[model samples]
Target: MNLLNCHQINELLSAYLENELDTTTTLTVANHLEKCLSCEKELKALTNVSNLVKTVIREADKTDLSLVARSNKINSLVKDEITSKIKATENLVLASSNDNSIKTSQNNIVKLNLRPKWSALSKKIFLSLAASVAIICLSLFTITYYATSTGPLLSGVARNHQFCSAIEISNIGWHKGYPKERLLQANNINLPKLDTLGVHFSDLHPCKVYKAPFLHMMYSKGDKQISLYYGSQEAVNKFQEKFKTITPNELYLHQESNLQIAAISTQKNNLWIVAGDLTKEEINAITSELAINSLSNTEESKLFH
Candidate 1:
């Protein structure tokens, strides 16, 4: 096989590291990397990121929840730490690699010391699922964002996402049964009758999305799961105007990027926000069934349009 250039090898480096390439392609990359110093450096960068992810996972829920740090600033701090740690490994690698003149280059050997240096890993999220699982598994972590126009709404959404991600990364909230029961017991959150609504909840936790107390419920059906939030009337209305847009129904539906969101007036006209990998119809089904049952069950006054 011909020698693979930096660009070509770069294309396959991630897959090579993940052992996703076939025998022939794998050999081609390995053989090329054995001779190509530049591509090897690039591969090391990816590996460092992976190691940082491991650090994050090890320090899960250890993030110093500053009410002020923005996501980008947190990222810069994390990268600087990685770079500093990488520097500390340079002389160690140089001392050894220099002895073996055959394959030695200016680049340092990649180390896998995943000791938690920073208070938390950066909030950056890796997107490609095929090449790496570290970043994907760790999930994105962002400081509270309350400066936006829709402060409560956006803040609530982001907090909800963070809580759900934490639960997911903890190896809970995926399977049914005892896991959900344990979470429910641990969090002491309220659980509504959702089984009749065709949505089987797996985990329930008492979470506060930017000061709005919600009983966050996680439910899975097949390959997808969603986070459903139940909050008081004031807390729900802070996100948006309520009871003004319903037509022939009592629920308001919203969505974004495969995120199905819907809010309805519950028994006390409290808010119910449902969002996740669910479809639009699925969101409507859960909200409608819940709202109808809630009304019937509580004998609450209807203020629908």
Candidate 2:
């Protein structure tokens, strides 16, 4: 077979570089390149330009260009000579010359198909990552809210108070096991007798609220019930330091539709909470009476020093 002219060879160069030509035509082109410096240089330039276009497309994420704008940019980059060369590679498949010189252009079309697909895949990956981050942040927020709001550290004790009040009779064994005398001797916290105030003590029990060991006292008069809780100064301090909500020697009131709670921080490094099914005034009076009694006891103890 005769060797094709430069013009015919030029048309087949793109197909030749992409390996889209038949075996015979591929060998013919390779043999021609051995003798022709100009055609060989042209092939090298085409490879470099094609690689450059791919690099720019891959790095599209670094820029703020829209998809259309990016596509336009790529079109511009492959314009004139480069576009003509790519177009030549595509057309080589359709060439029906007498020599059967070319193969299919499916690979070239597949490369062109990659441009938009790559951008879309990158966007989907980024969006999936963003959604995952958002979900993690939301989970963290929910955990923190419950930890501070309704967890055992804070207002959760109100639920404990309500539950204990509902079944005060079952606590008889607890009261028998931990009497008022054992409480004062062991924990150094004397339970005040509220008989003068018409709220009579019914039971005393040792219980734990989170990490704090508390002395739970049940007092009632008719339909009114009050729960008094006391914890040591050291245990209370650990809770206060971590939560930052409790302050020693301060009063905090918490009320719901059916339940009312009052928390008192005593100067002696102890915590006291009064929760009951009573009016706010009643709860306030009980807290105040306890606070005043605690103060009087502290004063009496100081007389010896």
Candidate 3:
């Protein structure tokens, strides 16, 4: 009988030791081990290692409480040293004031002088100003760190021209292209022939018109259904205008599949198209059929560009 490899034996040893393998797999391993001397030796070594680990853990859990007490005593000594230093600083300030003329005059007279009052008030103001500066510095540092860390991720999402929006669709099944004739019958929108559109039947779905500034669509390709949108109408329109001179063939060559095919004349061009995941050929077909009637004037284009 052929012996199991070291890796295979290790797998069986782990499962057998953990008691995780089901009856059939366990029995298979056991039968192989009975005929394989090399596997039996590996299993024995693994068992010995597991036993040693358990023994070590049990001993570690029984550590003496005196060690913990000593650690706490060390921490207390460090805190007491810090408190003593602060008290010493306060005492030094009080002692230096006793030798000054301001303190001598206050001791000689019962009435409070305006000079001493002003000095005390000024000290308090200075301390308050210092604290405020520290807080502002800390806040700015934290903001800068967060912005630096997250900037790249945000830039990537923006570059992809991808955004998401929620739409209220009453029927999800209809959008998935299910019960096809029934859905078309109810909506009174004829199912555009799949071959005529040059797209597979599975790749299309009916989507509802949501609030603008966001364009929402529900479509399915094979088993996957996706809802996609652009972030803002202004951003979309700006991008479309930037690429106005770009022809369908040229855009296809550049593989700029994220842009949608525009279907409006220049004057009434409110909706900007945003594309998602379509191949170059598919994008070319769509844009050829849906090109804008007029390109933006050179003067207007220059303003945005």
Top candidate by TM-score:
2
Give the lDDT ranking, best first. Answer: 2, 1, 3
Per-model TM-score, in order, reads: 0.34, 0.37, 0.23
Q: What is the C-alpha lDDT of each candidate?
A: 0.58, 0.62, 0.47
> How many angstroms is residue 265 displaced in model 1 relative to the true structure, after the best TM-score fit?
1.7
Model 1 per-residue lDDT tens digits across residues 97-180:
534333433684355433344424332332344336755443422222232222233445334354322222122323223355
Off by over 4 Å in 1: 1-190, 196-198, 241-258, 279-281, 288-305
Greater TM-score among 1 and 2 belongs to 2
**Which regions of candidate 2 deviate over 4 angstroms?**
1-177, 238-243, 246-258, 295-305
Q: Please, what are the lDDT tens digits per residue for candidate 2 over residues 192-281?
A: 677778999877766554546667787887767778877787656654554465432334444321445555665456777676666667
**Clashes per model (N, Cα, C within 3 A):** 0, 2, 1
lDDT of 1 at 132: 64
lDDT of model 1, residue 111: 50
Q: After TM-score superposition, what is the CA distance of residue 173 in candidate 3 from its true location, in Å?
A: 17
Could you tell me how far off, in angstroms, the CA of residue 142 lies in candidate 2 after the best superposition?
29
Clash count (model 1, backbone only): 0
Output the lDDT of residue 173, model 2: 21
Model 3 lDDT tens row, 204-260: 223322223433333444543322332234544654565556432232222333333
